[model samples]
Target: MSTYEASLASAAAFMERHERFLVINHVNPDGDATGSLLGTGWLLRQLGKQAVLVNEGSTPEKFGFLPGAEQIINASRAEKPEFDAVITCDCADFARIGDVKEWLPLGMPLLNIDHHPTNDLFGTDNLVRTDAAATAEVLYDLLTYMKQPIPQEMAVCLYTGLLTDTGGFRYSNTTPHVMEMASALLACGVEPAPIAERMLETITKAHVRLLQRALQTLVLRDTDQTAYLTITAADMEQCGAQNDDTEGLVNYARNIEGVEVGILYKEVASDKVKVSLRSRSIVDVAAIAQSIGGGGHVRAAGCTVHGTLADAKQIVEQKVSAALASQEASV
Candidate 1:
């Protein structure tokens, strides 16, 4: 009846055509990425298809409660396996697929299913819906159309994706339709408390130390409307925090009132910094990410910049400030 409805139908059509699937998401898979992979894996298996969840690194410990979480394989740990098709969920481009990008089945059908507007359309069948709140939203419609019953475990995974990507339904992307979809998942026995606990409450001691150290280094700009924190190798070792510990720290800056932009810079290696950007409103962080050779949604996005953390933080803050100022001028 509408464009999205037709698109949902097509996604269903694509699933029906495939018998075997290998699911991959972006590097350092977050709740949305991991949840999308798990939910899709469950749905595919329900249809008598073999679905293997593959990623560049280990699944975040926060998502261990999700269905099929243990089945997720590290592309670097074992030899890559061939599949009839490769499906990428929640990743905007091939580069974001990280180390596993090398193993992508060449000349085979690839499905790029996502909600980010900056998606590179790497899949033979590109199903990018920028209007949707989350990739999980797209999956919900497709699963319903395919007549696949959503089980409680699958519901937990989908709900985690929906919640985190939507900022616990507090972001601008949270629409009535998103709420309705979440309600449906809840009806399928998705409990908010434990899922929230698993996804939010489960934090490591190193993560807490990292958060403290990171906050100590925070710098504010744009008259305190923008805040950023940088983590160096020394900082990581001092706190005993790994790459995964850096999750959700950006929100600390974003949550401050009057702050329009928040940034977290993690020194992945010497002279290499991973920059994550977030905005409440009046800023399109994704555009900033694109300019710096990465892409994601408007409210939350990231890019890896080559240089010292200081260099990357300065560039990213300036870019985000310009975007925020431009939005202000327009108003």
Candidate 2:
């Protein structure tokens, strides 16, 4: 059997062997992260397995439309349940799961279902397929292998994952297999237009103001091949914006003409900055992120650095500039 087939079989066996499970994703849960966590939980429930969906952070209001999102409890709110296994979706590293790490049973089997190229392979039974486009895609394959019927609710959740991770099928990772899975989910009674509208088109006034502030800091570097933006804590305070409001602001930088890479630096703490990276064509932002203790896919990645916003920006800009130079030289 192929590697993916073998991994699926192992994952299915692991799930079957366990009774109670704790499903988790990254801290700042996005559509893909939230969708995968909820989707996997719903699937396990269909199999009569007890699954508790937990996150270190709360679900954003934008994803309230998802079927099982309301059921997801924050890690702080969750009781210490007797969990037989732990499954993480979309999170590339254990640290991304935040406080949920402390809640897992010691030495319990972990099923790492993810698509990030920078995955740390931290699970006992890893089903990390970097080519899958989204962790929800990996879950869909696992469900099919286990002969579980995809319910409408699961379909909606998985479709949301595929839709958001691929930027609504606009990103380069939107492969034919991704489209096939999306089509299958659609056949399971998911409406794409509504999901797209809810995820992409609906933006709050605070988000608009945050975008405005971010755009004001947009800077072109590396001879205009790189575009970067910033969002200080002051900007968030002035606009009444939370981290959720800055979700897609990095795209504005990436969409600039002649720019191959985009970067967003957000001051998350007084002495720390969170950096999001996106690349258009050749630059592998994932490698750059991994080098600095972060992980993600080729086109999109992120990492946090300890320093002032100015210091973080200078460090990241130098790294990105070197990566660009290396790519150009190799070409």
lDDT of 1 by residue, 175-285 (tens): 999999999999999889887776677788998999888888888888899988877888888887778888889889888889989988889888899988888877888
Off by over 4 Å in 2: none
Which 10-residue window of candidate 2 scores lowest in summed lDDT? Answer: 75-84
- TM-score of each candidate structure, all chains considered together: 0.94, 0.98
Backbone clashes in each candidate structure, one number apiece?
A: 0, 0
C-alpha-based local distance difference test score of model 2:
0.90
C-alpha lDDT of all candidate models, in order: 0.85, 0.90
**RMSD in order of candidates:** 1.7, 1.1
Q: How good is model 2 by TM-score?
A: 0.98
**lDDT per residue as tens, model 2, 6-50:** 999999888888999989899989999999999889878877899
In candidate 1, position 217 carries an lDDT of: 87
As for candidate 1, its clashing pairs are none
